[model samples]
Target: MSYVFQFGPILDRWPLFLHGALLTIELAAISTFVGLAIAVVLAVSRSFGPRPVAWLIGAYVELIRNTPLLVQLYLVYFVLPKAGMRLDSNQAAALALSANLAAYATEIIRAGLEATPRGLVEAGLSLGLRKGRIIRHIILGPALRSVYPALGSQFVLQILGSSLVSAIAAEELTAVSNNIMMETFRNFEVFIVTGALYLAMVLAFRVFFAQTNRSLFRWAA
Candidate 1:
């Protein structure tokens, strides 16, 4: 049982691995941004919109939350082409991941909204604040601050989940690892390095979020 270990080949392809890692970060960034936008819309609507609209949004949340993400990716991968909305692998992955993230993010944001006391709105009204300004400055800001940790954690999950886009040949970190494994026949080493890269990225993102949380919510602190 003497299996020789060699990382020289894997190390030699540093450029490939670096490219893949950057692409993975790119995918995560795209999905998180677009998903947060969608989540904000859905959350505000769910929290304050009419009953029928809330119900529809609730249905979407349930459907996306209950299903496997791979299935959702497959649906986007196959369905759009037939509908004449052509998108490449990366675009499709970004769209699918964004939708998936939005569902969970909507719930996170709505919970923050719910935790806000009704008296805050009343207080804003008493202070001569218009409804729009109250919602923006008085309500949403605090609510978003309350939920920033959860949202940041969700983005980390998004980064990890970007690995699945390899299923559609999106050429992200995991996809590149697979290619390296094939070329070097070093599945174990390839994954170990890829996992390390992912860990480093996640830790870096957590630090960034921490600093941002301090800067953005210093008033609350």
Candidate 2:
């Protein structure tokens, strides 16, 4: 089948595409922050809490990791409404993405926490540091350092995965591209531009994370 090459029509709707891209970024940002917070709590619980708490977190991580994100998104969007818990498409998408990212982040952070040296914990105790203080200052720092790159990669993936939100008419970049393609009748050209835009967004996120790492972990530098 032959495809049309109408870059002009796609370019004409640049403003709409720009709006969608901005929304995508905003959604990703909000989800990432929420996910990271959930991750920190879950990782801490898994690593340092009672056996039951640890087991619960482990189950949550396994369940989320084993399942497909699309299924999770669909369940959040469709099934919840049937249960009388209504949420709009964008809210459902954001909640699903945040929860999914939290699972991965939990595992990554737990690994980092596990890698912390026993001697440091002993040192903190000997220095009269409380368990909470040790975990907050000594452990959290090195643990985060160990997992920084993985966390950054996960954040980037979260941004890409946000594209799937478009399926629910969240008006993100991919959804905007679909509309553009339908309007312009230039599926290939519209997708090519959309793909480039996503790549640019990912690169921008990488740069921002790198700078954040430098500032946050000055000792690592």
Candidate 3:
């Protein structure tokens, strides 16, 4: 027996797929920004804050890093609603993805922070710069420059992993693919197209990061 492939029906849903792809990108972008912000705070606190505060942040990092993101999503979407803190699918997805990315970003950013030269920090202080100014002008930039590649890779991973949000019915690319497959009954064709879309998205992310890196950190390179 021979098997035939029919992608015509799946291709017919291009608008649906495009919408899903856009939403996936939006979720990843928002999560990356929010997560990076949280990560910066956590990394700074753990680096210089009081022992108790550092310990608490450390525990959060460890907890998120050790657990599965799926379980975390379940807790955020299902369990939190039971506690009267209801969130829609997108909100829950954003929260879970942000927290998840924050955990990994914390360590990556912390490594960059630790790699910063002590002399630069001293120089900033000698110039009568405040702690915030020193960190912003002297430390944060270099630290982020040092870890820009890693951060970019993490962002890509987060984008790909955004598929997990489908568990909560977030209407992202994977969810749309599922719906297409069900409606068209072209499971293999739908998945092949979906996988190709994901690949294109990942490549697009890489190109974007490369351009951004050049624009933002060419001097550091």
- Top candidate on lDDT is 1
Question: Quick one: best TM-score, which candidate?
Answer: 1
lDDT of 1 by residue, 37-126 (tens): 999999999988899999999999999999999999999999998899999998999999999999999999999988889899999999
Clashing pairs in 1: none
Per-candidate TM-scores read 0.95, 0.93, 0.94
- Where is model 2 poorest over a 10-residue stretch in terms of lDDT? 2-11
Candidate 1 residue 50 Cα shift, in angstroms, is: 0.7
Instruction: Give the worst 10-residue stretch by lDDT in candidate 1.
Output: 130-139
Instruction: Please give the range of 10 consecutive residues that has the lowest summed lDDT in model 3.
Output: 133-142
Q: What stretches of model 3 exceed 4 Å from their correct place?
A: 124-133
- Flag regions of model 2 displaced more than 4 Å: 1-4
Spell out the clash pairs found in candidate 3: none
What is the per-residue lDDT of model 2 for residues 83-109, given as tens digits with 9 covering 90 to 100? 999799999999999999999999999
Better of 1 and 2 by TM-score: 1
lDDT of 3 by residue, 122-196 (tens): 988998999888877877878888888899989899989999999999879999999998899999999899999
Better structure of 1 and 3 per TM-score? 1
> What lDDT does each candidate get?
0.93, 0.91, 0.92
Ranking by TM-score: 1, 3, 2
**Model 2, residue 130: what's the lDDT?**
95
